[model samples]
Target: MINRFLQNGLQGKYAHYQTDMLFNGLNWEMAGERPEGSHHSVWELLFHMNYWQDFILAELQEENPESPKDPSDSWPGSPFPSSEKEYTEMVTQFLKGLGRATQQASKDSLEESLGGRKRTPADMLMVLINHNSYHAGQVVYARRLIGAWPPPDGDESDE
Candidate 1:
């Protein structure tokens, strides 16, 4: 049940869900354009979210992932996507990273401490979920700011 929320679909059985919904219908311009008052664009936010997911997944897999404590490192930019193809590539990678994180989180590690950080592996997963949820809200708000709400092709089932 918990595993379903992490990577499978946005049908969060435990509570709120819907990552894909926020991003479903965005085109290159909609995603890459920064709203008037917002510093970070939607694309940047999605990339940042994927970065943390990949980072945690690497740690869980015992890889020597570079732990970027700097905010800029966590929120780097890409060449402005000149076409939908480039934007699609980033979106695909972001979703893939999330799916990988989901697979990693499915492993049972309730008793294993995360790098002696005291929080167990399970706790770390919860932290990621919370983090993703926080940014997902921002994505929704960004969409609304651009009048991109109710994404034409997005999943609208059950909010």
Candidate 2:
């Protein structure tokens, strides 16, 4: 079930704005940069976000019988996607898989641990959100550094 709290909370707008921020002036190079010592690029960030969304859904299904058990999975390696089309497709597929999981998840199922110390489906979801936000920030900052980022939508500035 779609969490009414999330739908009503800032999370809804936060996720949407983040997506918009990433796509505003994106290009192949901007999406595929590793940038010196950093381990991920914009493309990698997107891939990672989609990947863990699937992972959380998979973990959630260890107890619940209704979740999709698809074997194809999201992606296989670091920076695997080369083109914008492929990168977009991977994220799209990941979101579709997440949609299936969200449809199947129950509040009780989300709270149950899948074993280990204290991992639960809700924990898994939280991890994905946190990770995505981290990488999304990096992507936006990188875009600015690379001179790819466009101006802010409104008059507001970080300063």
Predicted structure with the largest TM-score when compared to the true one? 1
**lDDT for model 2, on a 0 to 1 scale?**
0.55
Report how far residue 112 has shifted in candidate 1, in Å. Answer: 2.1
Per-structure clash totals for the candidates: 0, 0
- Report lDDT per candidate: 0.69, 0.55
RMSD of 1: 3.1
- Which candidate has the top score in lDDT? 1
lDDT of 2 by residue, 1-159 (tens): 335432222132434333433444466556676666556666776766666666666666664334335543343455535667886776667557545644544355566667663876666666655655566666666556666665445222211
RMSD to truth, every model: 3.1, 6.3
